[model samples]
Target: MRALVLAGGAGTRLRPITSTSAKQLVPVANKPILFYGLEQIRDAGVTEVGIIVGDTAADIEAAVGDGSALGISVTYLRQEAPLGLAHAVLTAADFLGDEDFVMFLGDNLIEGGIGDLVASFERDRPAAQLLLKQVPDPERFGVAVLADDGTIERLVEKPADPPSDLALVGVYLFTSAIVDAARRISPSARGELEITDAIQQLLDDGQTVRASRVEGWWLDTGKKDELLDANRIVLGTVTQRIDGDVDQDSTVTGAVVVEAGAVVTGSVLRGPAVIGADARIVDSYVGPFTSIAEGCVVTRSEVEFSVLMQGCVLTDVPRIEASLLGREVRVSRGARRPAAHRLLLGDHSDVELAEGS
Candidate 1:
């Protein structure tokens, strides 16, 4: 079986960051979010992969290349616009050909990979199979209704009154039948060919559709909080590995990772946390669930539950938690007497300042 990975959304929800970088490229635990999906696809025994890319095609291509590094041969399928999931499948038709394939959303992270799902799909050979998870807010996702025999009875895309709590989990398995289903459906009210509609079309055409419940976490990293949550969950699984230099003045504890070339001095690193390559943490408290990307510097600061991207600097910052900092972002306290906050943020940036700090 082949794989079609969609890395081409306009990620408006993660604005400012998404404005300059692909959302799929955003790091969770110092690793690109898209990379996790690719790795899972490879682990599922699917090496012939096609990435559906849009405006961020160049960036995704530069990072993924031919996908040989990840044990897959990648073919880039250029989608003219950020249309929809069904549109992405339609765009990758040539690469997918007549084979059964898996469609994975690049920004979605599923724990434990999709090996079992692929195996089940191969064993049963259903016309289409979907991964479904019971979500608190079914209205926020494409939901599914199941029949008595556990077959997918119906599918709805962001319905105001959802039929069930089973939300689509961003991983799909399909035989060639889905291509025609996608073509047969019209654009939804949102002006895109919805994948839910295509799946509904399959049901309407008397094709077998099945769903498997996600036993592990399924994170759709589309917003800031969601991304941070994903980071925390992924970090919790890290094992303690200190490959970098930790001076006697520094104290490290728990499942933390200090990559090679990173230096920690007069600081406390409390894991599950990761200090990326060449990063320096001095006289600071790098708290739990934090990922400091490569070349970053943290001095006399306390950071917890945050993601500091490559080249970010945090100097004399008292405490920062549950935050996401883009590359090269500098957060330093000024020596001015007034002691006021200063911020130069990009479009759609969200910041909360403490008064009288």
Candidate 2:
């Protein structure tokens, strides 16, 4: 079996950040999200993989190359536009050939690897297997309805009123039969060929479709809040090791990873945080769930639960949390603006003054 990783979405939800960098490349624990997906795929014993890329194809190609370093040979499939998930599969048809494949979304984070899922697919050889997880907002994701016997009866994409809380996770296992399903399905109401629609087509044709409730943590790192959450989840599992320079005057706590070339002096680094390579933190507090990317500088700044990209600098900033700082971002003290309230009064109305009223 091969793997087809979708790296094509525009990631509009990430806004200005996605405008410059691919969402899949966004870092959590100082590692790209796409890299984690690739690692998981490699761990599943898949040797050949195809990555479907869109506008950010060049960057993705440069990062993965031949995938030799990751123990896999990568073939790049270019999708001119993100027609939909099904469209991505259609684009990778040539690379996927007639073998069973696993499709993983680059922006999705799954705590447990897909190794077991791949093994199960190989054993059962189902036409398609969908991973399901209970989510609070089922309306925001593709949802599945289970029959009385616990089989997937139907799959719906972002239904306004969902039949179940079991939302479809981003990982999918499919056999060669899906190629025909992709060709047979029509575009959804949104004008894109959704993967859920194809699965619905399979269900309509009485094909075997299975669903598994995910048992571990899962996150879609498409927004600032989710990105921060993903960072905390992954960083919490990393072992504590201070490999870089930590000054004698500094105090380091649990699960802190100080990469080579980084210098921490007279500062306190809390647990489950990472200081990237060449980063400098001085006289500040690096709190929990923070990731300071390579070459960043934090001086006299107390930051917590924040992500600083390469070359960012923060001085005297305090209580920073759940922020996504782009490269070259510089945070410093600013002059206080005068506090005043302006009101547009009606022609015949009198505005009350604070002193009198």
Candidate 3:
């Protein structure tokens, strides 16, 4: 089977960060979110992959290239706009071409991979198979209603009164029939062709629609808090590997990873945390669930549960927690006559300042 990965959405929810960089490229555990999906698709034994790209097409292409590095041959399909999930599938029709395939959202992180889901789909050959997870806020997602035999009976996209708690996970398996289903559906009230409508079309046409419960975590990294949560979860799985230099004045504990060329001096690194290549940590405390990307510098600062992207510099910043810093962001203590907070925040940037520190 082949794979159709959607990396095209303009992540408005992530704002400032997504304004400059693709949301799919956001790092979780110092790895791009999209990379995890690609790796899972590869692990599921599907090498022929088509990636859907939109405004951030160039960035996605630069990071993924031909996908040969990940042992998959990638074909880039450009979508004219950020239409919808069904629209993405329609855009990939040429590459998908009458073959069964899996559609995965690039910014989502699903635990345990999609190997078993692929195996099941290949065996059942359902018209469409969706991965569902029980979520408290079903209204926030495309929800499904199941029959007595566990087959998917009805699907709704962001219903005000959801029929069930089974929210659609980002991973989906489909036969070629879905192409027609997508074409048969009209755009929703939101002016986008909803995938739920396409799948509902299959059910209306007497085609089998199946669902598998997600037994593990499923994270959609579209917002700040959600991204941070994903980072924390992924960091929990890291194993200690000190490939970089940890000076005699430094102390490392727990599952910390110091990548080659990174230097830690007079600091405390408490894992599960990762200090990326060429990053320097001096006279600071790098706490758990944190990922400091390559070429970043942290001196006389204390950062915990935060994600700092490449080339960030944090100097004399007393504390930072549960934060996401974009590339080359500099946070330093200023020596001024009067103490006050200074910020040059971007659009939709959220910051909570501690008063009188």
Candidate 4:
């Protein structure tokens, strides 16, 4: 089986950051989110893959070039517009040929990867196998209803009143039979050819559709909050490795990994955190579940549960938590403006100022 990875969506939910970089390129644990999906596909024994790219095509192509670095030969499929998931599949018909394939969303992270899912799909050869997980917000996702035998009975895309709590988890396995379904279905009310509709058509035709409930975490890194959570989940797997310089005045504890060339002095780094290459932290507290990416600098400040992209600088900022800073961002206390709380936030960026401090 081959793989089709979708890296094309305009991650409007991530706004300010996505405005400059593709959402798939957002770093989680200092690694591009797209890279994790590609790695997962490679580990699934799928050697040939096609990536669907849209306006952010250049960035995606530049990062995953020949795909050799990731152990796969990649072909870029141009989706002129994100007509929808079914539209993406329809556009890649020629490349997918008559083989079974897996469609992966580049920004979605599933625990333990898709190796087991691929194995199961090949073993049973279902018409389509979907990854499902129980989520609190079923209305925000494509939901599924299963029959008594555990076969997919119906599918709905962001339904107003969801019938089940099981939401589609952004990973799908399909036989070549799906091509016909994609062509047979019409665009939904949202003006895109919904993949859920195609899957429902398969059920209407009596094709065997199955679902595998995810036993581990499933994260869609399309928003800031979700991105930070994904960082925490991934950071939990890190082993304590201080390849960088940590001065005697600093204390680095538990599950922290400081990359080579990073410097820490007069600071405390609480673990499940990472300091990327060339990053510097001085007289600060790098609290749990935080990631300071390459070339970032943090001094005389404290932060927790946050992610800072490459080249960010934070000095005398006091405290920051549950935040995401884009590359080349600078945050500092200004003697003239900061006592009143000033901000220059971007679209979709959420900020909560200290209460009357």
Residue-by-residue lDDT tens digits, candidate 3, 1-357: 999999998999998989998999999999999999999999999999999999899999999999999999999999999889999989999999999999999999999999999999999899999999999999999999999999999999999999999999999999999999999999999999899999999999999999999999999899999999999999999999999999999999999999999999999999999999999999999999999999999999999999999999999999999999999999999999787778898889888887777
lDDT of 1 by residue, 138-177 (tens): 9999999999999999999999999999999999999999
Query: Under the 3 Å rule for N, CA and C atoms, how many clashes does model 2 have?
Result: 0
Please provide, for model 2 over 89-124, each residue's C-alpha lDDT reduced to its tens digit, 9 standing for 90 to 100.
899998889999999999999978999999988999
Candidate 2 root-mean-square deviation in Å: 6.3
Better of 3 and 4 by lDDT: 3
Cα deviation of 291, candidate 1, in Å: 0.3
TM-score of each: 0.99, 0.93, 0.99, 0.97
By the lDDT metric, which is better: model 2 or model 3?
A: 3
Pairs that clash in candidate 2:
none
Q: Which portions of model 2 show Cα errors greater than 4 Å?
A: 335-357
- What candidate 1 gets wrong by more than 4 Å, as runs, is none
Q: What are the per-residue Cα lDDT tens digits for candidate 4 across 130-212? A: 99999999999999999999989999999999999999999999999999999999999999999999999999889999999
Candidate 1 lDDT at 95 equals: 88
Query: What local lDDT does model 3 show for residue 180?
Result: 97
Of models 1 and 2, which has the larger TM-score?
1
Alpha-carbon error at 15 in model 3, in Å? Answer: 1.3
